[model samples]
Target: MKIKLLVVGNTTDSLLKSLILNYKKRIKRYVNFEITELNIFKFRKIILTFSNQIIRLFIVEQLYRDFTIINNHPCHNQ
Candidate 1:
């Protein structure tokens, strides 16, 4: 399965961006990972447009702080 990360805001800190990019690259080796960054306004627009799909699972960053753990999951290898 493909994972799409929808970030509502951009990270202005270069160090943070670099860290995120590094993790993204590592995650890509195990699964089809993607990160989509959108400003607050655009994110709000999307929320309004896709209100019907509100039931979908939305994993917040705080909950998945260590996303790299996916590399250890055997199911993702498929």
Candidate 2:
């Protein structure tokens, strides 16, 4: 089975990236895992102000959709 981890932005910290890669290597011993870092867009300040909690909620909700789709796909189990 293959598991794909999709991320919106690249991790800037070299140490952190190395740590993640090391963990991925260990995990790959038992499963097929891939990490795809996507550079979609740069963050820009929004004119409309929203509370931090509200912004977090919206982001989580949106991410949930992507995860659900990935999880439900037949490839997820293979």
Candidate 3:
């Protein structure tokens, strides 16, 4: 299976980006991994369009202080 890491905005910090790339390289050795950076507008558009089909979303705060797991069910709308 392929794992995709999607970010709503660009990572401006050089150190953080380098660290992320290093981890990405290591992860690629075990599985197909990719990082996609999308602008806020496009990201929101995708979420609105696919909200009903999305099963779960894992979100991490900017400071990495906290994270959230959102679960969605199609039947919930019925």
Candidate 4:
């Protein structure tokens, strides 16, 4: 079983990369990290799924970098 860690970025840079890497290290035990470009203006509807779990939805912010979080599910795996 493998969990998915979604990291979205409105615009990516060094900071965003670092953020993803940092969070990835913490989350590596359970999930595989992936990053995607997003629209800052309409991030509210962006749904993040972790191993099929919708961890975040409808997040609104002027994001210039990345979004990071820690999550665990029943399917959390290596």
Q: Which stretches of candidate 2 lie over 4 Å from their true place?
A: 42-78
* lDDT: the better of candidates 2 and 3: 2
Clashing pairs in 1: none
lDDT of 2 at 20: 65
Q: For candidate 1, what is the lDDT?
A: 0.52
Highest TM-score among the candidates is held by which one?
A: 1
Tens-digit lDDT track for model 3 on 1-78?
A: 577777665665555566566656645654576778767685353443233212112122211111111222122214
List the RMSD of every prediction in angstroms. 9.2, 10.1, 13.2, 12.0
lDDT of each: 0.52, 0.52, 0.46, 0.38
RMSD from true fold, candidate 4: 12.0
TM-score, one value per model:
0.53, 0.52, 0.52, 0.31
Poorest stretch of ten by lDDT in candidate 4: 56-65
Q: Once model 4 is optimally superposed onto the true structure by TM-score, how far is the C-alpha of residue 23 displaced, in angstroms?
A: 0.4
Per-structure clash totals for the candidates: 0, 1, 0, 2
Q: Cα deviation of 37 in candidate 4 (Å)?
A: 8.5
The positional error of residue 15 in candidate 3, measured at the CA in angstroms, is 0.3
Residue pairs in steric clash, candidate 4?
A: 44-58, 44-59
